[model samples]
Target: MILIANSEAWPGFSKSIECLRRGERAVDALVAGICEVEREAKVRSVGYGGWPNMLGRMEFDAGVMDGATRQVGAVGAVPDTLPVAALAREVMRRLPHVMLTGDGARRFATELGFPIDETLHPDSKRVWWERLQKELSPEALAAFPDIPLAPLSHAITDPERVRDNTVFLGRDSAGDLASVTSTSGWAWKYPGRLGDSPIPGAGYYADSRFGAAACTHTGEMTMRCGTARTIVLALRLGHSLRQAVDLAVEELKDLRDGFIGGVVIHAIDADQTHRVVSLNCEEPIHYWFWQEGMNEPEKRAAERV
Candidate 1:
């Protein structure tokens, strides 16, 4: 058994491993793990505590993949819902679709009797507003919600670029692999921005025969390169876990234009070999890792490539 996840998943690291031990499928166990993070208000980058968009509204994105069948489901730009990761899993289980967005996703949530959470934590909203007030010009601030966001889009992103979105991957004793990505997305983003978190083969991909992979931060570049899928394909073609991750990072380096930022990848291969690597990241990245015999997951720095 093996589990690899970003630091944001620290709150629920043991829950995931225990789920695997309880005889849950990889996908189910991972979903359970991430749901813990989503429920946390202090995290501030996922679920209830997620930062609001420019309009001061909270929207979330989530994706889940089942490696055995390569079946996937994702929801993007959703609002008034907590833990959309579970909804994504349900989409994979119940619907014929691979992705759902906006009202469609909300309607599905309603069908499932999910409660609405439009009232985001006041601190998250206040911080978003304060930052926007500081960044926007007097005229832009005067225009406010009535203003066209496109003109101010360039000024509204989170200045720190702190992407704490959750990406969790696990390999069970049954040789099953699964991946899940859940995020509030880029802080102060345009209302409908859908990052790679909800896009399969970009933010996440899994195939039990080969391995599973997921990404965090810098979703735009990952979407363009299909980073997660590319890593799994490398493993399928007989590359070691390290080699596969190296190739993915090389692909990121090849990009000369478009949104370029740091990316941290978490992956586990069929033989339970796991790796975490960062690309173009200014700061060192750390992730959690655990195998069957370990009493607790280890926190270690990612290899910066």
Candidate 2:
């Protein structure tokens, strides 16, 4: 049995779970699916050619988890590595440590046959240069004091609003649970700023036997409080996935400063009961659910009870 949930988009993960039911292992299929999406989606947060850093360079971060074995692997602050999900998967297979960062992560990727190149895509390079110009101009700085232009100076200079925080979850028959989370971090972020995306329990989590996987968006706050883990634990306490997420959100709201982001929680009980919860302040919270072998995914929206 497998289940997944996120803030906005669901097709990629829903499709990946369908592939897994056809006899593929959860870890392999999920990672591969996410990698493909990361590359093709080109959403400026995940994958190559999307966004660059304040220094006009592209970097990536990703993580994978195996719930059955309780093993985890992650890479942070990596440069020029496409298919970062694959690298995170490799880290799980090759390294004993749970996390790797910076040059170490890059070295691991190279050892696994990944190419590191200095030539970034033209679009991303141009975005980076424009950010540089913004920083050089004192008028620009004075205009947008709240924008972290200095940090995210390399990519996504435009002031844009992101709606739902997308979360994807998948599980396999063998009860192997795996999750992959990739992001370019915040726009105009500092050169080496790492976000919740690459951090397990913040961006994603899985428990193979218990049948749960979760991922989060709007990282600035969730990363500080282990939001995913909190939701999972709430579910373990016999709360429905929706109940758990609601509680977790309430708790996080109290603890948070002005930070904002969203979370997607997926859980399957031992009885094969499944549920998903998506929470964000931008709009009403949302939910989804499915049982084992079910073909259709159910949907619901949050409203004041």
Predicted structure with the largest TM-score when compared to the true one: 1
lDDT of each: 0.89, 0.63
lDDT of 2 by residue, 158-243 (tens): 33433123345666777676666766556555678777767777767767655454554567666777766776677667777667
What are the runs in model 1 whose C-alpha is more than 4 Å off?
none
Candidate 1 per-residue lDDT, tens place, 150-179, comes to 766676667457665899999887889999
Q: What C-alpha lDDT, on a 0 to 100 scale, does residue 29 get in candidate 2? A: 68
**Cα deviation of 227, candidate 2, in Å:** 1.1
What local lDDT does model 1 show for residue 230?
97
